[model samples]
Target: MMVPEERRNADAERGEMPVVQGIPIGAPQGGMAMVAFTTLSPEEQVVLNYRLAVMCFAFLDFLTTLLNVLTAVMGTGYYWWELLLLIFLLGPLSGLLGAKHLHQSLTAVYVGFCVLKTIAQIVFAVYFFWLWHILFAFLQIWITKIVFTFCRCLSRIPLERRAQLLDLKEVELRMVYW
Candidate 1:
């Protein structure tokens, strides 16, 4: 669907979602589904972008930890409890909470949890002297920056507008690799 630029702008100003034009969306290679990126205001776009970044990083961390655990089980004969914790904390927990935060309202609890998790990860990384831990700590910090930006953008939006922005059922990725 295509909307004229002038009409889209007018609809946005009137608190209506405008179907964005010219953005192509297709599933990635190997049949991985991609989200459609449209019907969003610029502010919503910014928030969703940050949300997706956090999700991607968290997913990567989960995969890395899972791989580590698998390798340990196959070679070292046992996986550490720490690896389990990382998988649980960074995988489903972070992703679910991130989705909630983005699709709903920004709550203090989620922000606090993110901050505490980041601090703990960094501290543990330093204590353990693990390169991967340190790398993840850096990624956590990057996620924090995105969260901060998301919070700022969300705060500037009025309550009525906020609801509309947060009501998106599926987050649209601005860039889709076909």
Candidate 2:
């Protein structure tokens, strides 16, 4: 077995963070600003993955809202009421607020709103025979799933870890969510 000093030197040469039991104990040598991926706990990994998915969904939601506004302005489709709803309850803003504060209640409210919004979209699709509405409904469902999954995984991580994740400074204390 290699001695501790030799192991440290080898790891340093390889540009790897020093870790113990899969958790990073300190910053990498030479002042590297990246933590090894293996240093994250399983729950953190899940949260990270879900957070990315949620962001993508949020982008899609924004795109759909934009398209609706364009169509309404052009007088091709009367989406005035729908536009009002989207503007009032923009999913991404609520999600970002909840995530930044780590407030489970706000996130839960967001999930509830998403669920209701999805149901309304489905009903509108069926009643109005709008194929595009169906697609948007499906997107909303996916967004809801991603946000719910992220929130569940976030809840599993300790408050201290979550605080560290929000630091956004040093690699050792930062998470990839932002």
Candidate 3:
């Protein structure tokens, strides 16, 4: 009898091949499967990059929100409103819209938000009297830059390799269909 590894290798070699009894490998079935891929097209790579950017934005928003809340509790009160707006409104809203549209526009929105937030942090740091708040603001800005750099690196990866990295089969299917 063939071992499981041997079976998997055979399945992998079958090029646009079928696996299991009913499901064909690389067939796009919509929903989450659409995002699943063992190989990605250029367009899919763009989509993946945008998704990563959105995640980065969310992370930065969360960090800023926490900092703002802590500062407000400690009597600083300088950035509470801005941080609340970003955490409760802007970040979540943009993320929801991005998930709905799954378009490149979301990436642009995320990048714009990051830039704005970074600028806001720097300005707030200069004006704020509380040392802790200023330090947290600076840290948030640095974290945002790191996240942006990481996303840029991800965006630069070759499409074929990204597909392999993401292990996306659905994208391959979409390509076949196209």
The collision pairs in model 2 are none
* CA-RMSD of model 1: 9.9
TM-score of each: 0.46, 0.58, 0.40
Query: Which candidate number has the best TM-score?
Result: 2
Candidate 1 wrong stretches, greater than 4 Å = 1-42, 54-107, 166-178
Descending-lDDT candidate ranking: 2, 1, 3
Residues 19-57 of candidate 2: C-alpha lDDT, one tens digit per residue = 454544345467553444335777777765565465555
> Which has the better lDDT: candidate 1, or candidate 2?
2
- Between candidates 2 and 3, which one is better according to TM-score? 2
How many residue pairs clash in all the candidates, one count each? 0, 0, 5
Candidate 3 residue 103 C-alpha distance from true site, Å = 8.5
- Where in model 2 is the C-alpha error above 4 Å? 1-39, 56-87, 168-178
Candidate 3 structure quality by residue, lDDT tens digits, 5-112: 577678778854554322124543753333222444454445555555556556557566666667665676555564554444465356435433443344345556
**What's the lDDT for residue 101 in model 2?**
60
Looking at candidate 2, the ten consecutive residues that score lowest on lDDT are 169-178
